[model samples]
Target chain A: MEKIKEVVINNSEDVILARQAAREMARETGFGLADQTRITTAVSELSRNIYLYAGTGRVIIRALSKNLKKGMEIVAEDRGPGIPDVEMALQNGYSTNRSLGQGLPGTKRLMDEFEIKSEVGVGTTVTIRKWL
Target chain B: MDKVPILKMGDTLILAIQVELHDKMAIRLQEDILKEIHDTGARGLVIDVSALEVVDSFMGRVLSDTASMAGIMGVETALVGIRPEIAITLQEMGLELKGVHFALNLEKGMELLQNIGEIFYGED
Candidate 1:
């Protein structure tokens, strides 16, 4: 994997920046408009989750290749209060806040591969990828 | 943060969102639209998102909430110009965006609002 960029998600505006950066990278990677939209939407959800839940986080975009498959990877990491129940967090409509609670599950649906790691009071990290 | 420009035409208001809207800007737009409707007594709203590349869950929620709010204020609303890709993505993300009308483009959106108006008030 090769790093493309890292967008910090501190304020609400950073969520937009993170998604825009993902869109540009996806476009440059030759993904069609549908795929690009998917990538950007997934990034938007993840980055917003970071902003809403963690208050601050980092989204790192990376280019990955193995054999003939090439893909884009996004890693959202936050050092805020970690989710104690990761399973519950991944479920739809389970938001503690007033949000719609579609962030994690919807992001998983948009990407080809998804992974999440977190520890209570330790923080959380979510990684997702879409292949070309 | 550029505000989405709202144009008043007769009894209707049209909002064209040209810039990639941030969260704050989107909320600001909702407030602005409500204010405009209140000040002008507009009966219809058409939101054109043709230039937008993506409408994520947050944006979708804002649009839905704005539509509901406008409905409470007696303004019929229509969302127009959702790109094909965005339409599909919004569906896959489980954002039904119910209660708000939809059309292919701005002209059609206006027509929808007109039809809705005729439904509420007898067509003359």
Candidate 2:
């Protein structure tokens, strides 16, 4: 079992940066391109959500290898006005964003594992995992 | 989003689309446009995605499919004015939209439309 390493980034644009970093790490750690793409898409959705909906946040990326397989975990946390209705937010075709409502549900569909925790006026935390 | 009608060469029609191309609305729009293409038998379609900031894979795939569907129905599709940043992101993510045309600006897109004749001309 390999050790878990963590990286944290702040700033809205850093969402893409964090995804790039995670993709590189995932590749070096033995993940395939499909896994890499899925992870990045998931990251893009969450990171964009944090930037657009919440205004600011930090993306914490953790890399781990276990049982001869590589695994990556990403945690995106924001301290802005949280989602008032998480259930509705996760539903397809639902978006507070005027652009496309695909962000949240799209993220859910792309990840190997996904979890979201949020409270109104508090904050939002989304955790995603993928194994390669 | 503003919708505008475009005329070219005194005989062709190009509908200008300006809005977000997401999953929710993309299908209905695609179907409506396909029907319009069949009805008007227009020469081209100009989708202005400049105002759009984000595009997911599913939406990208749908657009690509719509372009092909239009081709079978005797209409050509052109995607004009995508931001450089968005283009880079789409390319990095491997979103290669097939059967569609792209231009840096709408003027250039309209210029490209000049070469593609009316849809009926290509029908036979």
Candidate 3:
């Protein structure tokens, strides 16, 4: 795996930046137009969650390869008030902010693989990948 | 402050979003469009997102909200130029954007708006 870009999500503008970076990286990683849109949308949801909950965070995009298979990876990390109930947060329509509660689960559906780790008062990290 | 320009074309307001819309920009656009509708008494609005390659849930909500707001003000809103990929992703994410009208392109969107205006206010 090779890290291609790192975007600091401190505000709304950073979220757009992160989306653009992820889109570009996904393009370079040989994803089709639909896949590129999927990757970018996932990045937007995760980055917005960071700005909303953590106030600040970072998104890391990477290119991964194993044998002949290639994939793109996105890692979002935040050091804010972490989620107390990870399972509940992943469920549909479980928003804490009156939203549609589609951020985490939607991102999970867009990517091929999803993993989340969180601790109350510690932080949270979500990693996702899509293989080509 | 990034602002998406809203142009008035007769009884219609045209907003062409050519850049990636952030949360603040989306909210600002919503406010600006609503104010324009109030100030000009526009009967129709056309939002062209043809240049936007991706749209997330927040942007989707903004579009939906803007459409509903315009509807409440007696204005018909048409969303135009959503790429196929964006449509697929929005569907997969469960952001159906219900109660909103869509057009294949800007010309069709303008035509749809004109038809909606006629249906709402009767033909002049």
Number of the predicted model whose lDDT against the real structure is largest = 3
Worst 10 residues of 1 chain B by lDDT: B90-99
Give, for candidate 2 chain A, the lowest lDDT window spanning 10 residues. A1-10
lDDT of 2 by residue, A1-132 (tens): 443434344444465476667667777767765566667666767776777777778787777667786788888898879988888988766766643466676677666788989988989999988877
Ten residues in a row with the worst lDDT in model 3 chain B? B92-101
Clashing pairs for model 2 are none
Chain A only: give the TM-score of model 2. Answer: 0.86
Q: What is the TM-score of chain A alone in each candidate?
A: 0.95, 0.86, 0.96
What is the fnat of model 1 with respect to the true interface contacts? 0.68
**Tens digit of lDDT per residue, candidate 1, span B18-101?**
988888899999999999999999999999999999887778888999999999999999999999999889878777686699
Candidate 3 residues A14-120, lDDT tens each?
A: 99899999989988989999999999999999999999999999999998898999989999999989999999998877788735688888888999999999998
RMSD of candidate 2 to the true fold?
9.8
Worst 10 residues of 3 chain A by lDDT: A92-101
Per-candidate Cα lDDT values, in order, are: 0.89, 0.68, 0.90
Angstrom error at residue A11, model 1: 0.9
TM-score of candidate 3 on Cα atoms, chains taken together = 0.95
